[model samples]
Target: MNLLDPDQKHRLFWLLQAGGWAGWALSFYLGATVWGDPPDNYGFYVPIIAAVGMALTLGLRWAYRLTWDMRFVARVLPFLLGSYFAGVLWMVARTFIFFSLFPEQKAAFGIESSAEFYSYLEGAISAAWVMFGWSALYFGIKYYILLQDAKARALTAASVANEAQLKMLRYQLNPHFLFNTLNAISTLVLDKDTNLASDMINKLSRFLRHSLETDPMTQITVDQEVAALKLYLDIEQVRFGSRLEVLFSINPEVKHALVPSLILQPLVENAIKYGISQSVKGGAIGISAHKDGDDLQLIISDNGPGLDFSQGITPKGSGVGLENCRERLKALYGRSQSLKLGPTLPHGLTVTINIPFSQEA
Candidate 1:
């Protein structure tokens, strides 16, 4: 409803046009009456002149629509020339009205004499400038709205694509994790450990149920991520039992900080796979998180044989968990988030993720 808003430019344009033409009519009336140029007329013709100017400009506004296609000179040039002629026609009509009203008065700016044509043409030239300015404003507003619409559509498409990618990455974890868990359960069954296999199956069901309940694109708190990771670690604990030593040093201040749903599960799994599973003694793994300025840093490190790569890149394995996490973070936060793999202390690997700290998704 704000008249000053660019979105309401059309309404503002009409209001300004009405006011401008009204001012022009009043100026004309004052010049005619005070100077006694048109036989001392009252303000009867002022309203008519204002109405005519408004109508003439409204017509020009309609004609200006075709002038936008500047590439086709044959089409655009005619509208430009016609607009100027329309202004001349408006002046001619006003001159005739004035001459008819004051028969005995001088006709210096009227079409009564061929000599007065120059004076009429001068008024037409001034009116042409007004039409030109109106056209410029109209085109400006039209193009601005068009550009805004285009940007909105592009942003919407990008958002939908990002969401689709996040969903794909989230679902990718299910089959991979399920296959590995089922293989472990099968090994326990082959060894005639029915009680341990039953427990693993129960833990796996709970983890899968939790994953299905939570939306892939929706973000969860660090505490929720930790809870999910605990469920995953519990399943691995059943398999590794005495060997898997897990530790959590989470900051209470960052418990509610937003993180992608099930983000920590893959990182913890990766830690156990490459760290605990590879070692004979099966070293300890640490999961910690804290708020660092405007960012939240999540770390998953384990005491095991680190990567052999000199550049410290976690090479893509048969499991696409790390790659999926990286791509998901990229889609969610663009370049604002990061995932880095580096050697932890003297030995072992550490996966550190830096993401913006927020309480909401």
Candidate 2:
């Protein structure tokens, strides 16, 4: 198992084994020297003992990586008994070979039993402790690394989702504006209002130029978005002159706050199409921007019919304009930012937008 896959049942199995070996080397000086309250006489054999224990763990980890159901008491129960027997076997073999070669230091076994039997049991228990310590450390480190990787992946996914939403908003903007301007041009040609048509065309060209020029990642100042909206309003006024009026009340501190480009135009367009166009007396669109604690709030209201929740429509809001704006807000700032639609004070429609703000802005 490649320990890197989080979804795998036995992820980090091999990684833990490698880490186990490393920990054993650190704790016992690679088994070249024994450690305890009273140092052993044969400290020089530490490396050999450490090496054998680590090798066994490495081999066993590969052979019997526990499955989902085997990870409980059943797996834990047999490990100690099996290790005890294995340690005793290895210890006896080493004791026999060493004592036969060097008859002196026969006292090294310390047990009345034959040197082979004594060494076998002693070495086994010591090796078992080393294996246990390292295995636990290895799994601890693996768990930590996995947690960090998961957080990084979640952050990356959120960033990608935001970029996708902005692209969707860009798609909504281009076609929506083009159709309206073309319809205006058609009306101008039919009425022969050549001068107004030329002016509208110029303003539309400038608005598009400003929008397409900016980098998508950069947060533009609220002033810039408002300027783009004004340019668009100028063009629309030529076609809807005497039918549209715009009133703006902006707080000085909020002017330099940042927002996505063209954020306000969609709301204003909704006002014009749904309110002013329908009323015989025409209507006024009021825009206000102010700071409320850590939030930057921008509101636009028009004296028109409010949203019809049952029908799922509002003054041209059923199209991509307002919905695209909502999607962009959700994507960029998530729930930290919000847009709300409701009835205006004197019987019109209002859209309120609240976004996080920086003191410098």
Candidate 3:
């Protein structure tokens, strides 16, 4: 199925070679019949000439292949000389075949003597032009193919880099979350709350397991991503207890919409860390998703201290998580996706994400 495969390329080359020569023979025959006086057995002669031209060009192809890696300037001389010689050889073969097929025509033209090579001169010049045309077309096609190959390589490299960047961003969340969770667990252990500490460790294990199992390069359904988010939130819930409140308002229609794995985790973590933890009476975190025209709109907001742009664009302690989400979205969807931060209601920060809505087949 891959036309670029070596065997397929060879097959394609032969197909083009056979087709081009066949077309040339047909065109030559038609032009002679319609635009000029037809010679005896001319139909037979044209095919022979076409076949000879194809054979000669095959030699030109071999020669050109040898110089394929050479610079343009270096290739020019070989192309010119090879085409010229091939053209002259083609004409020589055509003249011999023509004379053999219609012996009377040579006598009628008063060129019975083989020593006088002038008879082949005009034909050779015309044949050289034909070969030159073929050579030009061949090189043009080769240049186009090389350009396509280069473009394919560049795209592949970009895809690899994009995946690496996404993985780096994705994996960054784990250690950041893990460090915070472990610190919380350590505090509980120091306070002699073994029961609470054990429960937190169990939740942390499940969250880490899910995180490690999921591939950053793969996408998960909104429902699946939310489930994973809950695993992380479960750990935080244990730590926060009644001090933290979580809410979900996911639309049923968009539940199965595909999104990058753990895309919302860092955002939610930022909300909890910077928003709820900052307040004496911890604020409620709201997560919602719905279809917005052609896009899936996901919003995570917190009723904690809102961002102060006077400080800078990034909220204090929220830059890494927000920037990670932003870069991952850009890597996944380029400009087709967007993440925006704004004030929520009377207080706190709201992050909105818009991505093209898609589902698995």
Q: lDDT (CA) for every model shown?
A: 0.81, 0.71, 0.88
TM-score of model 1 relative to the true fold?
A: 0.82
Cα misplacement distance, residue 212 of candidate 3 (Å): 2.2
Q: How close to the true structure is residue 334 of candidate 2, measured as C-alpha lDDT?
A: 81
- The digit string of per-residue lDDT tens for model 3 on 236-341 reads 9988999899999999999999999998988999899889999888989999999999999999999999787565565433468888898899999999998888
Best lDDT among the predictions, by candidate number:
3
The weakest ten consecutive residues by lDDT in model 1 span: 1-10
Query: Would you give me the overall lDDT of model 3?
Result: 0.88
CA deviation > 4 Å runs, candidate 3: 1-3, 36-42, 107-117, 309-318
Model 3 TM-score, all chains together: 0.91
Native-referenced Cα lDDT, model 2 = 0.71
Q: In model 2, which residue pairs have backbone atoms overlapping below 3 Å?
A: 3-12, 31-46, 31-47, 32-46, 32-47, 91-120, 92-120
Backbone clash count, each prediction separately: 0, 7, 0
What does candidate 1's lDDT look like per residue over 117-208, in tens digits?
56656745676665666556556666676777677778888788888888999999999898889999999999999999999999999999
